[model samples]
Target: MSSYKSIPVTMIETDVSYHKPSQTFRESVTLEDSALEVMTDFTRVTAISINPCASLEQARERMVSSGVQMLFVTNQYHEVMGLITVNDLNGPKPMQAVSENGGKMEDLMVRDIMTPRLKLEALDYEDISHARVGDLLETFKRMGRQHALVVEKDTSTDKQIIRGVLSTTQLSKQLGYQVQSSHMAGNIAEMAQGG
Candidate 1:
């Protein structure tokens, strides 16, 4: 029979030279000044947005070619109005072809299925990957969002505001500073055996 071992969760705490008062709760790490900082600047957001009135078919084609999952739906005023996802295009009631329904492309537009512009801003991070993760966690807490439109400006009429798109999966992989559970516990077990 093999001997068994128990492992405890590892939490990191460091003292800063110029310390702000610490948080007073278990979730203090996230609630306190975040250990993870997310960012959205001009550099990261450099693409042009899609027109909200465009045909859903054209929109789907663009996402497929660009290899991105989300698009920024802009209005005549160039304000961010809504978001559309690849999955939305492929959903059961996805944008139906006008020909299939005896309609035309002009009759079918993106605004129909788009998640309305509730929170159209990007979640920022210091680390791109981690920031992305942080953005996603925040997005989910708010609910009804699958993508974040990364932007550089917030003004309603800023025509220069074409930012990158953020997917939840990409952020999680690169967003944390904590050691992986398996790595830490495995190393500890090895050390215990050696002693």
Candidate 2:
């Protein structure tokens, strides 16, 4: 979508392969050229984040302010924890309903009902480059999973740290199609070109 010259993926291996729902493929994929110098580098990151200590209302506010569907949860030390999505705030707790006949910001706390243990449940792309497009598409099949906290180990501290957040909405927008449709397209993109 730009008029400038593009980055070429002419330097990588030609045996790039991926599997899809209907079939599998092996192809050579070229990427637009950029300062990063590689397609893999282009996927570094670009997501908004929040702290787990904040109130649920505060987290929701941050997401709304940032205009991001997902909010990466972090701790006081700035280590990544888990995540919360817009969908997580939509429903009411039965206890809240019984107590006040409705839920209010005051009725909720970040830890009271948030999908707990997200700090330990985060997943990471240890081999991010190997995660094919088909795998990405399969992730979209899950419900209410727009934001995912990617975990990585901090060797220095021997602690698990949050490295990144993956928003399905952002993925869909970037690819210009439903996340579910990306499997085949991604698999195709991963294949080796005949030329």
Candidate 3:
């Protein structure tokens, strides 16, 4: 080995606030931006994903810990198999699973309650780019979905890719007001009356 001087390492101390993680974004509650501009880009924000085989309890815990309302269920190849949201967890699916499984939460998995890709509806990037915030709100209301996926084809792979996600909560925060769907409200009223 040649006798060369090694650089000495210097450690600088920083404030704890500098290393702390940031809270959920509080977007300006205004509809000045388009849906594409308001949508959460996976490229910019890391999407939380969980395995399909993970227990429902585990998935819920992960979502709570990450402060996210939804988690993507992925396969061994890391491809999105489905998606589970807080709504799914609180809905009747897990109860049905538990009742059928001798009342055990562990018996339920993300795959059991997740909305499969086949049932998931997505908007094209081109369409969304030309859409306004009001258009997205109307779509979400009509579909009664908390989140909507935006998909696009990869030029090289020719496969669909999840480009972005529009979340109602995120949109409301950005729009500075709550946007409710008449259809959803009617459905809720009907359910309440039936019950």
Candidate 4:
């Protein structure tokens, strides 16, 4: 039998501060930079999410509090059912939903205006892994989307798992310029065409 000795303990310091997590993004990045530099990797940071049945107000509150423009609408099992963005909350979708469903604004749920999983699309992580920021930007412009999901196949389950997200707002922050939305581009094109 082996005997274990107790180690001596020291008193805790009152003025000591706890360590906080710090994630640093490059102050500036060119389009030639790696796409991974702009992606919000789920492996490093937890994704913000909300219940599908939650009120639209609740969804908005969560996004505001989290400093995110989008939130995944998850089921009880934590499976993503859809996603909601700030545009869906503040745009005409809410009013349209109310008018179509004959419900008051307060009665609207997150699912009422969220983009369903069926309509959503993702970029394979394998492709993103080798892509440049410019390639990602071109993809976003071609798709006419402000945000895109990145997925990787789970080897054991053979299921697609959302691994990260690419957001134009985040890209803009990293690039030191605003990435125009599709709507903005459309308006610019309209003016150019003298319509």
lDDT per residue as tens, model 3, 13-59: 77533343333454563343577767877766778899998988899
Instruction: Arrange candidates, best TM-score first.
Output: 4, 3, 2, 1
**Candidate 2 residue runs with Cα over 4 Å from true position:** 1-53, 79-82, 92-105, 118-120, 142-144, 180-195
> How many clashes in candidate 3?
3
Cα lDDT listed for each candidate: 0.52, 0.50, 0.78, 0.86
lDDT of 1 by residue, 17-59 (tens): 5443321222212312332333223353334458977888888
Q: For every model in order, what is the number of clashing pairs?
A: 7, 10, 3, 0
Model 2, range 26-87, lDDT digits (tens) per residue? 23212221111112211254456676667777877887876766665667765445556676
lDDT of 4 by residue, 122-176 (tens): 9999999999887776787778889999999989999999999998898888877
User: Model 4, stretches more than 4 Å misplaced?
Assistant: 1-22, 183-195
* Residue pairs in candidate 1 whose N, alpha carbon or C atoms collide under 3 angstroms: 37-125, 37-126, 38-124, 38-125, 39-124, 39-125, 130-175
Candidate maximizing TM-score: 4
Query: In model 3, where is the ten-residue run with the lowest total lDDT?
Result: 186-195
**Winner of 1 and 3 under lDDT:** 3
